[model samples]
Target: MKKYFYNNIKSKALLLTLASITLFSACEKNDDLKIAPPTTISDADIFKSPARIEGLVNGIYKALKGASLYGGRFLLYQDARGEDFINVTANNYTAYEAWNNSYSSGSNDINNLWGAAYTAINNANIVIEGLAANPGVVTAQKTSEYVAEAKLVRALAYYSLIISFGQPYNKDGGASKGVPLRLKAENGPENNNLARSSVAQVYAQIIKDLNEAEAALPQNYTSNELNTTRAHTSTAIALKTRVYLTTNQWSKVIEEAVKLVPQTQAPFSTTATAVKHALQTNIANIFASDYTSVESIFSIPMSTLDSYTGQSAIAYIYNTNSEFYVNPTGILGDAQWGSTDRRRSFLRLSSGKQFFRKYAKPSPFLDYIPVIRYAEVLLNYAEAAAKTGNLVLAQNLLRAVHQRSDASYVFPAAAISTETALIETIWKERRIEFIGEGFRGPDLLRNLQPLPAKGDSNLQTPAVPLTAENYIFPAPNTELSTNKLY
Candidate 1:
């Protein structure tokens, strides 16, 4: 029952000078303003040092990658909620409850994910507020970049929450209810209880934030991994493509995606920007540990020293010895892309069971959690082209992804002549290419498809339909008691 919304958590970077505060303990409307410790560092004291400001930003990133956030359950739940995995009765993993779509509003997985996402959002809110208040703490350019990064992370967290707790944006013409959009820092008790926004309104705010971020973020970084892991102008552009796609802004998707992924080479690439995000010769090696390939636009780092373990780690649940096993029978389990398709090798057989190796398990389950990727950018460009009747360019982009994986899997032009066919091809490739990386549930929802039915006779969770109620998880019971708006 720990309240992560205002928990006093710490990261490796002990900027405790800014730590040790729980914002909502009183639960009284007036007390909500009391976000910091009674004698916490003053704004002047903390903001005078650039290191402290950076530490606050670092803390936000750490919260974003928490076990309940992207660190584990958020992505893991999305994958399980999709139709790719087999829900065998014998495989009674407690975590699979999300995969089965049978969990209640009281479920810990649902509640924790809800709380953790908001916590990350709150962290970003604090950074945004701090940076804005102390305009003279850093150079104009540095301040712009840092504040831009905070906005980028906050936008991402909001989008993730909207996806998990609201209906698809395309459904009902974007009129569906979205989760509470917490933008301002809740440092005081100023009527903080707010109702949900419309899905359309949320997207509008997200777009506003991303546009600001894209304009302010640095165009280049000194190091490759640093560029891949942190927010930058290209990251904002790449993420915009995804946001546009989900909101069904076809033309906008093409416009933003083309900036990152070109028809022949990676876009947003130049001697100045240095975003060389084209496919590597071998797609199989893209997920190699400690290596940041040209295709990784933005990812959260994980390693031996900073890796997820126990049930919260994605690799832990996907392990054959654990509650799940790779299915060997469906189009998902055994799709015949080509004999030489590199992705076909992504699934591995261990201890008499096939396991998904897409995230690329290190000795201790620490594959980087990708948020937006170059491969996805490419697909976004292709899908947008297909949707807008630019069939030739669409096919070229789609074929580029296919050949990158197999090198010889030639996609015939006539096979995907119609827009529907080409779009389907791109979607299928996205599903296969990102297997176990957590796109299955989202893909299904965006496409308005039914959740994969229970593959086991003994399990009794019914098939999930394309209803708004089923699409969004209910507000967690914790919120009901704590959040006045609920």
Candidate 2:
């Protein structure tokens, strides 16, 4: 897979350069390139045809596959930064630096994330330019829709950077400093010395892209299961819900989620059959050999045999020595996971430390790491409704997700009666439901909630309040060196 990636870089950059446009290929070799003599494909010719446009759009998805967002590295960055997953395991020790401490300078994972996400943004910008220059490239409805999909992904990549490295859009940190914005297809001296835009501006771009994306995207591309690979209207809406909540745009959160829920999609919501949440009920099924689970809205494809490079966070959680596997016990016990539950089988050990088996692959193939899921949408609605004083609606949504996890369990009527309790319950369910996934850090940061100390195993224990200032991660040294923005 790495070789395939390398070859694509060589060809695409050459093709784009020959086509007379600034190239931003993520797979492109990280070396200096001199603009060569022009060839057959002109800037006019590149986007004038549908094939070229399709190729450019395909690059957007390909860039997204860069190690920063997926390809193993992003997974580690997310875990190391979150309250879950301690680096007791020696795997990827540098990653533990960023997770445990917000201010990391020379961390490779941090550096890689900044570079890769920027590369994706550049590719998106190139495509948007092409679409504008050559409107004829997408005459058909499907092609046009795909163009919108590209915009959504581009927005997503930028938002990832903003939330992690900077601050929420409406906060003081956001106003003070943010990451640089690259919205053109230029590869010259002029590209240097650009300053960081305020988080407000960055979010403005994100919103613009998503607003257009929501309009162009389909209701659901291929149902909840298969839709994990593709972007749809609901994913965009759900993402917006998160973005707005981060920026304290409560009205927007409520508005976006309302638009999303009524879509009434499967896996997105279960039937009364009590089988709705059964998909992830086994716990182990969430990380099964099958990547296309019913709950995953979108994920990075990891192959055990070929594509498995190993995620740093997963490696740290499960200590993997040559002869034996070590698991660090975090929240679950062996009995809690149960021998029958696949998650427990893979993630738990009788030895004091419990390691996660979900991401464990002896071969090169890794499990499909989820980026978005239907479960998040449910949680989003529950939180938004609870915040808006809609306790009944929020409780029902919370119960919908919780009931799916353990079908036999029931919530007392009084427990569901109040807004605060229901909100807290929904939050707890989110912590459990999305553990080991990347959402915890952002979820905590966005809600202005506190990070749990190592001692707070019982999630119900009260947490010290965290603020928006805690949301901004210090810019890595590499970025600071290249662009004095930090």
Candidate 3:
């Protein structure tokens, strides 16, 4: 509650200028100071107390809450840019452009996203450096956990950046250019001119950091601020499934997902205390204004206590809309299940007005932004296992997620008789399951699939191939101009 530093990128950037040393985390908004690294409290003075260090770490989560990052806008951008949500405002031309798959490197949304991610990555680096130095105060366990958390935060940022900015790792062995991998916590003019890492290198670093994170983090933390809001072993494993899925590491994806999600129990939470990672019965309640449920592996905490403002908020997207419309197309319309699924309870069709009920307001803007969930982990395993010739295991995993949302739903053996069919079935399930959750587009990109016909009108020029030049977001023009390497 009331975290200071992470709220805005300006203050985080100011810290870097003041320190003349490395700044940590970077997921704040700063249209003016483009390409600046993330920051924390003054190193020597702030480290005298453990509470300060804790708050600094808390700041990392706060920074991530930037509307441009996870607070809400990122989800909106992903979904709107994909096939689900349509931009109906007509006046918001940039959004329509995005829907049409034509956003440029100079696009404000692209720049905003690029800045937010680097801010988080840098902030994570700052934390890692501070924890390693120890400041001669915090306990060993605390230090290790903090360092691991930093790595996790950093990995999430880097992975997001790589996938969004460069080609998917499965494309040509990840030979494309990725955003700069700034690992060290140092501040110098030269540090600002860093080079892009190869997509493969970025993935390797993400895996390495995640491994350190998984090893150091505890099984669970009792509070939402610690467990759900922060990283834990299960959180790391959950992320590995996402990472491997994107990189096309079929075996590794199943392996990591299986580590946390049980093959038999299906939707059970793993930790002993506070029911850390189990699936809750009610599907609607998970997206309500209250704190996250057992299925929440990692999420950014948002609520009436800490409300989101501006266009980025979920409340703005679904609730206050003359701008965007909740429209699920492509795979959903193709898969007959979307019409009858029980999870459609999350949607509302009143007086011909349709919008998702997940962040509906009377509750205003209090949804705890989901980063990943048990359902996704199961789906990831299902996809990976199917690809790896484990049809039985794949069917079981897919059904676990399916049955949770629609009790009447069942997968027949003929539905997934072959490995190709199983993979296709699981992929379609993801399209329905994650609708409006900003995953549909990335799901297409990573799978090397085509765009589902970009929202009818602006894309009338013969649907752009998913392989178009601007398919993935380009690196921010600001970063390209600032760096000598470009």
Candidate 4:
């Protein structure tokens, strides 16, 4: 989990350096003497060797683990924007602006997140282009796998950016403007003036990349660790389920989901060809020491040497320092979430305040940040089944996720008697299961639901309606300052 070469670049100037081919020279006075080794390697040299090429591929994953991206802040900001959590410290360095729904184009979180995501995207683009330019550097099969891996990472990064900066696709059928789509490698400032694409256009590219990646990616890696951390066939299919779910493509969701998740019964899992992903018998094991569990479809690996610093870790913000705590009157107050439910084990009370313990790691906070899980895929399939008039299959899918945590709890007859009630029950299960995992904001926006308000005596924020300007994050000032077309 060591930080790769790409993590050192922190600003836009350094970001543009990704495509630069640095050269070294020595003075004539030292012509007779041996020249010192060059400090930087050219991008061309990197793709000439298999090891260096693999390093470039790993760099894409490293970029996603930045604190402002998926590592912590992205998850923290998404949860803070929802109603399930109340700000404890109101610390600006944390997600205060996001919790209050008051962030503007100039906000630090907005700019940093936008920068980090695009940095990852650019790194992926460089890998794809560099590998293609240098053919026969590796076997054709290995080359295809490497390029497909990069495409998957690029697709994930674009999906994150479009959902954050642009309006939800379900709102206007993706007719509104989305983030700028950068496909080629940007070695200089010439491409900085590219205009934003439509939301539908972005999604179409995302699906296209995913489909290509799915066809080329390996069914499974050699080990459990690689299977959980790297892009594979199941990984791409699991993500498609989520993307299709967001766009309200029910049949597409079901079509993509069943590739990985079998539709049979309670113990749902993939076949031996793909990674064996199933719900952990105990809900807590996924967050504990066993990070390489089959349940994790894909996650950003973290370790003591390469982990979030200061308050950037999710554990520090929610568990250690207590910057935010669970909202009593929010989802936790729902009577349907029984007191005896095993999922309640994730909740902890300290000094009369309840906080989420899903990210329970201490100090360096070496918990792997989950990008997608099997439970989520199951729930996504369940929702899609319910929407497409397959209630029997939907109920079976819902029961698999629910009973895995609480074996004795039963869905009341009224709860599953109708299509509407069953769908509502599935939604509630998602909120409880993914409370601190960053699905809250996306869940609200995908359905065009308003962001509900929540606070204590210290602060009170209003609900942001669908028509409000703050419903979605604005394009960052950094992009506007450089991209003239924006």
Best by TM-score: 4
C-alpha lDDT (0 to 100) for residue 181 of candidate 3: 81
TM-score of each: 0.87, 0.77, 0.87, 0.92
lDDT by candidate, in order shown: 0.70, 0.59, 0.69, 0.82
What is the clash count of model 4? 0
Q: What is the C-alpha RMSD, rounded to one decimal, of candidate 3?
A: 5.7
Clash counts for all predictions: 3, 18, 12, 0
RMSD of 4: 6.8
For residues 121-237, write the lDDT of model 3, one tens digit per residue: 767777777777765679888898888888998898888788788887777788988777888764434456667889999999999999999999877765554466778888888
Off by over 4 Å in 2: 1-49, 90-94, 140-143, 169-174, 219-226, 263-286, 303-306, 310-346, 412-416, 455-471, 484-486
lDDT of 4 at 98: 93
Model 2 over residues 1-486: C-alpha lDDT tens digits? 011111112222323543333222211221111233665565556677665575566566656767557555565565555555554433334454444454455666666777678767777777766676666557757666766777888888888898778755554646756777777764443354578888888988899888998788766543434355566666677678777877877678878766646533323453321112223555556676555565665666543222434344343334343211222343343222333323345555535555555565554445566776667767777787778887767776776665565555566666567877677667667755676666666766666556654422322222334463434566766666655434
Q: List the candidate numbers ranked by lDDT, top first.
A: 4, 1, 3, 2
* True-structure RMSD, every candidate: 6.8, 7.4, 5.7, 6.8
Error (Å) of candidate 2 at residue 317 is 6.7
**What's the residue-level lDDT of 8 in candidate 2?**
11
Cα deviation at 53, candidate 4, in Å, is 0.7
